[model samples]
Target: MTTVYIADTGVFVRCGGPDKSKFQRLRRALQQAGVSLRIPQRVYQELGGNPAADKYPSGDIPYADGFEDGWIVVAEELDYANPLVSTVMDEVRRFIANETDRDEDIIEKADTALVGLAAQVLDTGEADHVVLLTTDKPAGRAAEALLPQHGFSDSIEFRYVSVAYLESLTADEFW
Candidate 1:
């Protein structure tokens, strides 16, 4: 079964700066495993869109190397026309709002795009399994909790991309 790996902005951030060894470690692991991480379009935007993000030390990501080497890709735009994609995104918004005890209006499509893309990939049979690499607790939990209910039980996994997680990463993680 093919497994699609989806990554979020935090994964790169947790890898530290452009010159950090952690960034190289992650790149090496993925390249060795022959696996590429697919980022939701929103995540791709978040990684480099904010001018302010450049002020932080961790924001100077060397992800361009991953792209140039062909191990980090920006996924296709989320297809709202796909019922499963639209439904899951809407549900994720509500799920995250409830989890944070905030009003539903406070949640945005960008916040749930990870889960939406996962749902779309799964529903369309693009992947037999989906692994989410994210530091967004709410979205990760929502994907784990909701995807199973949609008949994806055991087919979805969320790996919290912590500093330690990246520090000790190996090809085994992707396998």
Candidate 2:
């Protein structure tokens, strides 16, 4: 089955420094798997949009190199017109708000886009399973807890890509 691996910012930051071993590990893993990490537009923007982030050693080089190497990619535009996409996004918005105990209005579409794209991929038969690679506990739980209820049982997997998760990561991560 084709599995889509969705990555979040923390994964990149966890790599640390330009020559961090974690970076090589992740890159090698994806290369071996012949699968690239999919970043939500929000994540892409978050990685490259912050000047403060640039100060960090890992952030200094940015994630664009991964993009160039085909180890990372931006998910395609979410078809907002698709009812399933729109519906799931709304559900994610509500789910995140509830999970984070924040106001619904404060949750932006981009925040919901991760789950929405995952749903779109599943609903469209683009992927049989989704592996969410994120450090965001609330968001990961939201996907795992809610996606199955929507009939994607056992199809959505959330892999908490914590510092420890990647700290030991190597080209064999997916192996």
Q: Tell me the TM-score of each prediction against the true structure.
A: 0.89, 0.85
Q: How far does residue 28 in candidate 1 sit from its true spot (Å)? A: 0.7
lDDT of 2 by residue, 1-175 (tens): 7889898777787788448887887887788878888877677767764323432223434765787677787776788899878888888888888978899999866557888888889999999899988877777887888788778999999888877777776656554
Residue lDDT tens for model 1, 48-71: 643334322134445667766778
Off by over 4 Å in 2: 49-61
List RMSD in Å for every model shown.
4.5, 4.7
What's the lDDT for residue 43 in model 2?
73
Lowest lDDT block of 10, candidate 1: 49-58
lDDT of 1 at 14: 85
Model 1, C-alpha of 50: deviation from truth (Å)? 11
